[model samples]
Target: MAPAGLLDAFWGYERALMANDLVALDGFFAPGPQTLRADAGGILVGHDAISAFRRGRGGAPARTIGDVHVRRITDDTAVVIAQTLPSTGGRGQQTQVWCRTTDGSWVIEAAHVSQPAAAIAAAVWRVVGSPLVAGAASGPLVGQTVAVKDLFAVAGFATGAGVPAFLAARAPAGDNATVVAELLAAGASVQGIAQTDEFAYSIAGRNAHYGTPPNGAVPGAIPGGSSSGPASAVALGQASIGLGTDTGGSIRVPASYQGLWGLRTTHGAVSRAGMLPLAPSFDTVGWLTRDAATLELAASVSVDAAAQRSLEPSFVVDPSLVALATPEVQAAFASAVAGLSVTSVDLGDPDELVEAFRVTQAAEAWMSDGAWVDAHPGALGSDIAARFAVAKGITEGQALAGASAFDGARAHLDRVLGDRILLLPSASSAAPSTTAEGAELEAIRGSTLRLTCIAGITGRPALSVPLMTVPVETTAAAPVGLCLVGPRYSDLALIALGAALMAPLVE
Candidate 1:
């Protein structure tokens, strides 16, 4: 039998967990760097890390203890195994090593949790299969699986675009999008159609209708979108390639936030036929992967070599652009840049270009989806609804002016970039907390747009390399990508450079 007070302490800890009693929970765990709590997400080491996670997690799911088994190893140490029956109808097991400290109170030193596997995560995927669509017999991407963003036309399924009403109104596609066909031909099986921001307009990943997808990197952070689903699927190891589109920062933002390699091909480099468009002027096809090699392989089959232009290995840095990121991101960028050969240059006013890009994007978005949105009232989430409202009000004159400004900025950046690569932070900061809202969220979005809009305006190939990390509350460290903007058609070359840069770190 267990010690006199051991079961009491265990039950007390359970109460604390279900009630989300942070203080009491903290007291239950031994205070040390060696304390551990692990789950399907990842491991949390140290009392501080565990505490931080609990504080941000809102609360644990409602569950009842089903079976309890205890083994007393010594007078002061014991092991406990408990079966948990979640209110949601899942069986899970929790294992913990408990020890009686000098104070004669039992505390958890280490823990491991296992939950039943989910057939499909609704938020991450709208539809899934063992293999939604089979790939070719053999190719470079053989055995690879793809998460096709809902914006892409996957044959036999309607592109939902993260809107229930829109999806209900549309008919199943007769053919796959050009990019989807290319991937299928390259031997990458389609895993399923993943969720995207409503109409692929917003970069923030929260889908108000279906709920937000989990961030694989940061436990309680937003999974950057509109490519949120694909990124999450890849991060969670559900797929090998995340076929997505980046109009503003859909691919890169999520790539950075989730520590994946994302490549936004040069504008028009990959066919947009059969794919949904948020902003035609800015929309470009891209891929997200956990590693650089997978990204390169996926791009090889789609990008045309003849169209690609070779450039020197030289790199450039725009101080003004780097300043747009958070201090932690800025510091990380500086450290990374310090080791690379780069030249400093001025990229001009970011806000001007950002505003111009927004205006143009809004106008295009209104033109593309306004009719549908108008037909169906209250179909969009508050955030996107508000954006569309602004888009609805933009005068044609204002759109033309914004387009003129964008054209000039695009030309200027193209000339400035020449054949050299521009290095910068992929996002303004690490992924924002899930609770962040209102002005704070907008500020982060604005800062990120300032960085992402540069590539969009220029229509250049920008690669988000998962090379840096920033400290976050939910985990020990959250990733922030080091973005590389190259000349048009430099998609393959950019991937090569990123792989080489990451080689040393992986070693």
Candidate 2:
């Protein structure tokens, strides 16, 4: 039997709907693809769509629900059935499946309306929402939809960073993130905030608090994190562009996994105002799109170009780093860049480079969230908790040493690639299986970061072009990204170059 309080809540929802109170009605549904509503007029899928429907429909016929029967499906789930007597109707029925979230709030996950079936079919959408509309202005991205990673604050919404506790505790943002505001000003409609790894920590897409966002690019494969949601959303066609933050390949890794065009802008190229901090030193705003041209369009809207640099066909390939790719990836990359002139460059030991970046990033991650962890012990996912525990061991001296090493590497790269780009695999391997765990997962993270950390260490721009696919056990071939790192403040040039390089391959 459903609780008496739940029955009261159901009645409250009925009142809100009857009154056509958009704000009050919105409170009744959960905020993701898990929420669904179907009615004779049309099916309104997702919270945003439902909200929009409510706003557009205006006042509905007055109706009174009676003879309500609520059945408990579980302690946290229930079904509500009721008789609806509309003021102008013959007969009607409503059924709702309600679920209780961790915060002990009841929300409608699925709903159905009948007896007016002849009137219309239900409008359906992938269940998700946190929509914020853009101003009515025409620009390059006027008709495009951009899904923002939850780390960036959208006005009137809270930054979740994929942690339930943090989300619950945070206040609604008063203003949009700098990048988000820029996109809106450029005439792109906001699609809704997408999930991210907790505090944008892990590179694996799975969130400890929230569930993993689906990787449409690779069936049964990881959707690389912490920008997982935006990448997955863009790849899945839920949105045309995905606005995300990249701190040590968060955007690049997910883009590779989802087979989208992802960019990690030059460090400090974009403002981070109103965005949650992970590792400030390595953090940068980036985005993903299905095609190179759209990627360039989004980049143009967001990037305030420091100076334009001409695209150079000659690229420096580090064979030692290229060898890090698995046989399948190696072959795909070789084929993808077959026509371009590539010259080998000695970038030094890859393992050492990985460690240097790791220690410094770990220290910074700890610096950003260590106090919070101490305050809310045991709230983090075990994997993240374990990583932070290790991070705590990184000493000040060690961080300094790591920084020194990174500076040396950056200087070396700057000296080597005078005006050319450095070409490498975006990740050492394709997206890992969802079942991958323990040492297996960590090993993948380790190998992947070895390649991803290069851009972070140098504070330069890096673009991941999904030019080929590599074999994975779960799927026939998982998409692989070929990374191109360029000089500092050369973000626009990199995007143009990426488009030029990818056009011949994907187009």
Candidate 3:
């Protein structure tokens, strides 16, 4: 729902952007606005001051600015996103974010400026993730109820890897995952843990341990998994955010289908002490939110263990922009990238990297669960059985060599990045309209993960920015997501980028 009279002031912001007048842009924000960044010291307090700083950039007029789009957040606050030319001299390719003021003025909240074709998936994360590091706030996130994923160890809830037997065998845990503890310390209430796919495997939102949560965003359509339950709850508006995990497309798939922001941090940057293992190498904890700022705030709490870390922000755009998504989905992502400040890079053909990931992941799945299967063969999904079977053929030498190859890839990327973020696809498509039991389900699941598996194999940091939504022409269901992928430990960078363009990304 959009705030009443939102468009009344949109032209003002448009004029300011067209004129590249930072002063007018600065005047539009609320006092004491929160701005986050990496190397730039994450949080920016004092709305007035932040505006002054943004005005200093003296950006040029955008090449193209999409029609104003607004969503109501409160009586006075209206979240706004628009596509526009980012620079004064450049052709159309940019995105903008703004919040409405009481005086009918719109101020820039954040802006992600980039080329039109590069990509514009502002940012995407997940149900919720990573161990929450300690924070100094006086319980800013308090009173909110967060639904935990199965992997997160919650003192009394058995960590069901979506396996019923695992739940029965594992005694209730004695401690909360770091994320849960931090949220608790911040004064938040932890609702009971939610369900996920078998060990966060499938993307259909179905769980062998917990029954599938109804898809609030798309009733009959699968709720997208492996963070199935968390996304389900958030879409239903039952929880503030759902804590989830992403080894491949698990988090983003659900978040996109559910029309939420999902973030996948650079692996190793966030601690994984209390979560169940999928691919220890690639698994990343994430969170879900309806909009970008909420997603950014969640990232702020975890990036650098609650504001202890920051990095100079940089970006990467793969030269090979293959058709990874449907025509409409591609169009949406393209519109999003146009709204950001992005630089292009060549990541080459992703086929090799993606296939290796599959091999490595299977081997790992078997190592983690093959033994479990031996002990409790009855408690498994056919997908699990199939995955384990594939793992059996992975030779120890192959696994070792594969591990080395993976490390080499990560190391190479680290050198290339020198701490910048890499933008990649969240999935080949948005939420697929099929059931775990549907005829085309398996193909759809495999198809979706094709582009996202690269991150999991390398243990790199990645986040999904829910930038644009392409409405399904065939159905009444409104829209699907466009996503972003960043490098390892670039969670905060991803947040800043996402926050900057969130408004237009989702609109």
Off by over 4 Å in 3: 1-138, 305-314, 319-322, 341-344, 415-420, 435-439, 473-478, 505-507
User: What C-alpha lDDT values do all the predictions have?
Assistant: 0.92, 0.80, 0.63
lDDT of 3 by residue, 430-476 (tens): 55543334556766666566667656755665566656566442233
Q: Better model by TM-score, 1 or 2?
A: 1
Which scores better on lDDT, 1 or 2? 1
Residue-level lDDT for 392 in candidate 3 = 76
1-507: candidate 2 lDDT, tens digit per residue: 786468778978988887788898989988864467776333455676566546644556788776888888888899999888877676688899988878777888888977643221111111244345664488888888888888888888888777778788989899989888888888888878888888888889877666666677654567898888888878877789999888878999999888899999988888899888988889999989998788888888767765545575668898888887778888988998788888889877889888878888889989998888878898899999888898889988999998898788878767877777889889888887666766887887887888888888888889998887976654456799989999877888888788777676555
Leading candidate by lDDT: 1
Sort the candidates on TM-score, descending order.
1, 2, 3
**Rank by lDDT, descending?**
1, 2, 3
Greater-TM-score candidate between 2 and 3: 2
Error of 2 at 53 (Å): 36
RMSD of each: 1.9, 13.0, 17.8
Q: lDDT for model 2, on a 0 to 1 scale? A: 0.80
